[model samples]
Target chain A: MLNVEKIRADFDVLNPESPAKAPVYLDSACMSLKPRQVVEAMNDYYANYPACAGRSSHKLGDKVTKKVKKARELVTEFINAKSDDEIIFTRNTTEGINLLANSLGLQKGDIVLISDKEHNSNLVPWLRLRDKIGIVVRICPTNEDGTFNLDNFSQLVSGAKLVSVVHTSNLDGVTNPAKEIIKIAHQAGALVALDAAQSIPHKKVDVRDLDVDFLAFSGHKMLGPTGTGVFYGKLELLEKLSPFLVGGDTVESTSYDSYKMLPAPEKFEAGLQDYAGIIGLGEAVKYLSQFDFKYIAEHEFKLNAYITNELQKIPKIKIIGPEDPKLRSGIVNFYIDGTDMHKFAVMLDEMAGIEIRSGRHCVHSWFENKKIYNSARVSLYLYNMMEDAETFITNLKKILEIL
Target chain B: MPCIVALIVFGIMGIFSASHRALAEEAFGCVFKRITFRPCNTGFAEKIKGKILSKLLVRSAFLAKMVNRHYEILSWIFFILMVGSTIWVGRGVYNFYVYGSCNGLNESGFCAFDPSGENNKVTSVGDDSSCGITQQSEQNVTLENINLSGFPAINTGSKDTVVFVGCYACDYSRRAYPDIKKLVENKKSNYIFAHYPAKGDTMFLGEAGYCVQKEYPEKFWEFNDYLFTADKDYVLNKSNLDEILSKFGFDVKKISDCANSAETKTAVQDQTTELKKTNLYGTPTIFINGKAFVGPKPYRVYRSAINKFIFF
Candidate 1:
């Protein structure tokens, strides 16, 4: 069992006894609030050895280089990757997916499979490839309640060069059967890349167990610094992929006409990197590793269950995902038919200092398909407690009565 | 509709705050869209409404719900009120510029620009708190059927007439005398100085003024000015009056005899009756071309009241 009160003490913004008003943060899905440990780790890098990595030969340079390598090793261990060389630090999940979109070497008429409700990070990059390189883009439709449909995905996986889909939906919070999806995609000779932006924070994602060819997740969404993300791939597959962005640090030697590029991660990571953010991300992973994934999952489910049960009692709310709270994980997305969710979200902030995500949640295609404009989403994390959930429900009830 | 009100309210507040400046810019965009017959799709109005409703929700959900239901109608009502008050304020500023009083000439009321209504203050006619007389309302002040021929006169040949009824001992009248004297000399209008004792211990100056005007007509204006500008404590000394009469080249004994005569005393009494017929309720009441101004007006107000003069 997670001691949420003890956990909340690690986040300065969640301190209830402070003179300043503390927010009831329920928007962890959009961006989780950073713990003080992550912030101090970032501050430590900037305050002490603020230097470039992998290039300089001085003492500060060696310190930075070692810290960055350790961060890469931490990420590798976190995802159960085979080697540290397989990890490439990018800006965010969007950048990681963009790197794959431009580097995957898919030719014209090559099919790329995606779910019907993928975030724009996963969806738009494929759409751009379809427009630029004539790659065929196919969408595997989900069930009516927005759960991933395995038989429907199987029907679409044939003749596909790559099956890239969201491992967990940011819009609905349903974790797809990635192990099953990878097993089917591999038998059909299609490589699989999972957009794990919404998955890794709540539960365990072992790349070796699932045998995923590629996986990407952002640091900001998992209590790390912004502009830090990880892209993981198997060594052989990463070596086969073309470098998307190459510059100074990506090369081993250079001539006027030709240059030898570094291997895998280095060739993929161009120019100077976000060293402080990477170091902070390593600290975030270290902090998260102390807790068992089972506890984190259970804590999230308990909060979501309370919110979902209360929300279901409301008259006009239409929850966007499956009926069961366990399937939806920490996320509870719903909207009243005529309520403006932008105003709704702001009212939540105004009334009780409760913060939540509103609007399309970057899944515009799903909202457009269903012809529903937007929804308010409350995404819980390990730091949240029943009191926070109760405050949210009380405020929401007041808002609904008034608005 | 709320955007219009928001633009004005936030536009003024924007001058002092950066956050409000952003809202003001949003409201500007909303207003621009609204004026061109397009809907204000920026959601600025809804955002402000939500903020207001959220505050109301904490105190009373029922009240918040009522306000939310009638928000559009309430916005229209507030918009109309904002426009109406803006015009009213605009008119008040214009009145303050032209008449020296925000409410209008000689009307004393609470004005934001002049909160104390200092521009409309006057030495009351018969309502000196120490005098035990009931204060009369200023609304009754008028200039009906009052004969000005009996008062001390200057530039009598000019068409534009300026009649000033004041007392030497009153501070408001003393403050107004110099400006009126300059305007009469500059505009070359017929100027009349009527002595009405709005305070006690000033009745003797009225008798002295009548005697001086009759005996030393040419020196009367300069001597009258000396009385107004002199220290009130010095002018109240009866000996100081005889010395000033001698200094103005009037025989002190002859002026004193004329001032103390039964005929002069009766004439001063008749002058007071004539002054009362004009219905003046305060000292320093000036009539320029028959328009009565009943306070120590700014020179601009006095100048603006002259029909033949070009006003700034």
Candidate 2:
């Protein structure tokens, strides 16, 4: 097991003994706690080399260029991608998904399959493509219990050009069977893209292991700086996809009349990048790499189980996802009966210093279908401690009683 | 190579909402997808140079080459200037945002006497004595609660009401701050902080006291201690509120709402009403046993007044 106390020391906000009560930060599955190292990396970039990279020949520019190169390499290794060439930095997972939606040649008659539990990022891009180009978007069904239904996926994926699904959901924290889905999709002669925004932070997601052709995830969700994200595609597939954003760095050379486009990653990245965020992302990956996935996953499982068991003891509170804590990953969504969820959330933060998320969890489509408006979500991270879960459960009882 | 990577970093870092959106999402994600992806355009200089070189090349290729050769030097200067300007402008913008004016001087059309700023200071303006309209409203306040919530009276006392009507940021207020704080620390008298915000931001700063008291009812003094002792020109905003509230681990958004609430505004109005009752001449005005201290005075004098109120 990771020495969580030592790891917690790296995050100033999570230290329980600090003068200020460290908030029971259960919102990490949305955006993880950035280690001190990640922030310092970004601050160093701003303080030292606040210069334009790639375009400038100055010393600062060269330093920035080198930092960006190192970051790309780190990301390539982090995802275990084929090469750094296959890794493209994006604004966030949404952009990565959008890039694929616009670039991957899915014509009017072609089909794209997605899980019903897709966040708007994975869902909207395909829907837009379906409307803009003549393509059909098919939803693969999840069981009544919110687990993926493999039979329905096989039925809907016939003649589909691509199957893109969220690796893990922010809604209920159930990780979809991506490897199995990928294998099945590949058998159906379809490409696969995994929105790993929630999964990549918690577990080891090797592209080689899953045989995933495309993977999209955000840095902020993984203890990196915000606005930094990664889009990983197989080199050949990336080469085949046309450039979605065409300007600036996307080209090797250009004239008024003609232009020669650059390689896969370069062709996609058009605007000035967030080097600080990118470098910080590299630093963040290095920070998380200290603890193996096995340790991290186990820590989360224990905390989730503890919190879930405590919530089950409460009267009239319903856990939204799978009853099994392991299936819920680190996310536990529940709503107490006979209370306004929004007020419950406010009281939790104000009264108990327990910072949690209460809303539809951005899976409003699924919520709307069920007619459930809001739920209080306690999402954990690697830095979260057993004591934090105890505080959450204890505070929860106090809030419930007071409300 | 430069173009591809140039923007990669800048685009990610410069977009304000990148981290802001992340904060909102990590907090609970967004209510709506307001700004999903806004990439920072990093190669602006290159684009301008490209345009300039293209224009110059049409005229004379030799001159364009000559200019291109020295572009590295020009870029170095540009980079330095941009960084310096961002820092410079950032400070000015922050000060103006916090202090309600440039250079962080609170500007009330009526200038009360300030002992802190020298004549040369950019923040100082208007005669310090000019703001006073000779004491009006003769009905003296009893040794009890006023119309507004200042600091809740320490204890219901037969002791005289010491009404303090001043801006915490004003020159004389800075002088009186520590001494009054010393008295407040010693629990000298029943102090009523009747605020007359001579500067712009202090009104909201006063409102913050009442707002904060709503959440942590007992920490009004602790909050007041922070207000009186911090940097003379430090301003309050949402993020600054985040720092202060997080210290106590309170909900920043809730406190911020109360600070900006209509009820808080009513509390400030009551403060103004209380200020009117004090017959205020200038800031650092102390009303003890129906007598007044006009400007900053000795700690012993305040001690004597408290001594008189208790013993007389």
Candidate 3:
């Protein structure tokens, strides 16, 4: 029972004059459009109180520092972390994974376990580490529906130093059993990192409940600006890890001969940060907080279910991932028989003014596993309604008729 | 007394042995130098010193010249060789540390644009001027005219039926005098071309050749042919100009004499005034009976629009 029309109206981009004004925006999984509030918050920062955070002693600098600290606290609270000091702002989930892979001292004979359903960002770093540090990487098998197999994961995690897995699959919208995986890995005395890039926006993620050693998510996917993300780690473990990139802010004391590093979060952060994007992310989280997570989830589920049911009526259109509405979050990946996905997407835009994302969706390994070259994904958010879903299905049916 | 005498005798013998060894070392050095650098000896140096020096200097100079001539070339070759060796070492290091080079330099290199090669021809009609031509033929008559102004003019008989065709924004006028003369000479019966020099105006049409088929059902086809001829220059440069003109079977001379002709000056003045009045800024315009049409239209529309002013 989300007020989708009201929510849609709040975004300035949904206006008729906008080039990106799609009849139905079903690519929220790829990137969600920002609300006016989020944009305004960032604008306010730039217009009135623009300053570099934690650098100068002026009022503007203090103001920026205070706002940035509050943003960290907000993110920590949203993720249910024990302390705000554990949060480190990053460019995106990819940078977060890279930071961990490079910082952690993985030696020869050490093993890192991951799942096959991982995004390239998650998969490549581990592969790179295996090449650099002689660490072994074992990929846990996924089910046909792209869900994690707990038993298979357990077998893979044994004697491994790290078990990194995606909390939710971006390709299939199947939520992984990260909590159980974390529990088993902890029992086996292994560190766990969760790629929450797809999970953080759709549902409430309590890192404490999941008990993961590290969690990474991006701001753009959750209705904030690009080039902004958050990386969370347990404070104790964060203290032990070295910073991969060391620079001006990361050092506490320095000499020509040697340098002493700063503690934890500051040490991890090097160079200038995307302050505007971070401020926008903070505002995005606040804007999202207005809507109840349960209601938002239900709204998205209903729209996705409608699209799934309607798309199924057309012959030769096979939907990938979980068929059950309960298991699937908001994405519906499908392909029309004998129609090139890119061509189909283009025709839909030009002929019917409908927009969709058609590709491997960056989970190339999963698509390769399924032997699919590419797919068209219609991902719904809380602002989407049943009417939008109906229009999408109707247009899709028409497209099939012609193609 | 015996021990003291033995010590003194041993010390003297030791000193004598050391001195004798030193003298022997000096003698060996002197003998070695005498043997190696003796001026009288017919050894390698004494026998071929001049020849060797000449060859050595020549080789040294050649090597120095080679080094100077290809400093950057040698540096690049050395860098590439170094990189190759490092990669080989890296492969071995990878094998020893982290298994083999499964994904190491599998491909020859990264994709890059070839600077020496010509780029692919951009096919799409980019701007209004870029949609080079459209041809139209009508009722046993062909009207060939410049698609734009600033081109050579064509003389037309009053009774001739010339049908005008408009190109994309009057780009035809920008053609060189040779192209305009070719269009004029190729015309079978009357020439009708559009003139659009500014924005927000109708096209202007002119007449040339036998029967001026200005307004007719076949005007669109005739105009399209003329425009297509002009469009051939879109891709072809001067080297391929002969081939391009031969493709259309057009044999006309460059209009060098028209540079200071009264007709050319009058046409230019008329175009300038008309463009100023109508505010039509671009090319492929049409002027028939002092009326004009602007912008591009379908061949059928062109035929119907031209038919309003001329009869076949």
Candidate 4:
């Protein structure tokens, strides 16, 4: 077993309190707290080679280029992608999704199918495309508890030129079986883009094994700096796709009227990228790689199970996604019987310093379809322990009693 | 929904009837019909109350019953108060328009000084805590040239450059790192590093990087990286500091001796003196050209400031 306490020690910000004490942060789903190593790696970039990457032939530029290349390699290895050439640095999962939406060259008549449970990042791009260019966008319906229905997906993917779905829901960590979904989508003669924002950080994601055409995730969610993300596409597909953003380091040669664009990743990069963030993401990958993902998966599962068991005792609380904690993986989203969920979250926050997010979780379409206005979400990470879960439940009991 | 529409129609009729009690047909019928029809019919307001209070039935039977009984009455009372207040507001508005003052007060500042509704908005001054600008420590003093040894600046050509004097182990300095890095990447200005050790740990970081720089020129940047980017905060006493420096293939004894030596200690003191000379109240006291660009602001701020200095 990985020494979780020792792992907790790796994050100074997570120290119960620095001066006195602080709240138990259960909002890692939003963005993770970085370990010392990740922060330091970024700091090193600024301190040593604050130079821009690829644009210059100077020593500093060479150093930056090397660091960024290594980062790309690290990201490639981390996802177990077929090639480093396939990875393109982006701002976040949202940016990655936008890149695909704009660059995929989907026409007016083409159809794109996504799960009903996708986060706004995955859903909005398709919606925008539908509105902008008259492309047809359909949502694959899920089971009552928000688990993806393979049958519904099979039905939805038949006409879709591309099927973009979230690998795991941010609202409730119910992981869509990506491999099966990809296989089905491929059989239907459709491409697959898995929004791995919620899955990439917490568990092992072998992109090759899944045979996903494109995958997107935020570096910030994976213990890296914010404004850093990855968009992994099959090399052949990337080469064929058009660039979304043009100019600056995205070209090889140019005429007054026309320009010859750079290949694949460079063409997509467009401008001076987040070099420090990319480099820091590499360190974050290294930091996360130190742990066996089975351990990561197990630690999260147990913690989620503990929270779920306690929540089940409170009859008024309704878990929103899957009934089983194992299905949730690391996130437990729920709403209390009659009370306003936002008020409940505020009370939990102000009263006990227990930090949990409350909202429709940027999946208003899913919420609108389910007729669920909002929910309070408690998300866990590898750094989270049994005690954090226990404290949350204990505080929750007090809150419920007070109510 | 029809019930709400009917209530709205009745309320308007009642208000019109109350104003013109002399009218025998619609106005008279509306006032009598509204109050009488509303209480008996137990309108949309009552329906909404019942729907709402029914939720409390699971938690407390007594409270739920009380709420169910009183909810309609409460709703009625609220409606009356709203009407009364509206009339009062209308009268006040009439008075103000004719006399240029509200609430029957002749003074100019009366309504002006009446606290704005913005004051009562949920995200009022009191609620700024949710997304507050952290209090910035600022200084308007002219700063001196800070001495830096760790890493060479990109451009030292013209005096048109940025010398960011800061410590690595600082929380605030970490915030400024990305901004500073972005600034360096965007502008062609010379970027220089000057160490102003705030804490003991920072002092050790300074010494460690400096020692590594002194020994191996090529590895200095790597050592600097170890200090800043590697962690949130570093605990640099003797053992771990030695372990970190030694990992970089530096002679541990020489670096340790270099740290305690009068030279390095005096260097830190000299750096502190330069910091004092600059009137630096914070980390990342940035100077564009020779002008101390004040505030830990965005790249845009530096852009305008740098342009003014260069072009002028």
What is the TM-score of each predicted model, taking all chains together?
0.85, 0.57, 0.57, 0.58
- How much TM-score does chain B earn in each model? 0.90, 0.50, 0.25, 0.49
- Each prediction's Cα RMSD? 4.2, 28.0, 33.7, 32.3
Give the per-residue lDDT of model 4 (tens digit) for A3-93.
8889878787777565746567788899888998998999999999899998899999999999999999999999998888899999999
Better of 1 and 3 by TM-score: 1
Docking class of 4: incorrect
| DockQ, all candidates in order | 0.54, 0.01, 0.01, 0.01
- The per-candidate count of clashes, in order, stands at 0, 21, 61, 10
Note the Cα lDDT for every prediction shown: 0.89, 0.74, 0.64, 0.74
lDDT of 1 by residue, A16-119 (tens): 57577889999999999899999999999999999999889999999999999999999999999999999999999999899998998989999999999999
Could you tell me the C-alpha RMSD of candidate 4 in Å?
Answer: 32.3
- lDDT string for model 2 (B160-260, tens) is 45656556666666667677667755655666665566654566677777677767878777777677677655544424656777776677788888888
lDDT of 3 by residue, B1-312 (tens): 112222233344556698545434433444455567643221212112222222333346455345435544654675566668668766554422221111221111111321211111111121342333322111111123323343322454543333343332233333322233343454333454443322222122221211122223244334434534455444223344344334444331322233234665466556545444433332333333333322232232223323543222
Please provide, for model 3 over A179-222, each residue's C-alpha lDDT reduced to its tens digit, 9 standing for 90 to 100.
Answer: 88999999998999999998999999999998999999999989
Superior candidate under TM-score, 1 versus 4: 1
Interface RMSD (Cα, Å) for model 1? 1.1
Higher-ranked by lDDT: 1 or 4: 1
Candidate 1 TM-score, true structure as reference = 0.85
lDDT of 1 by residue, B69-119 (tens): 999999999989999999999989877766777787777776687776555
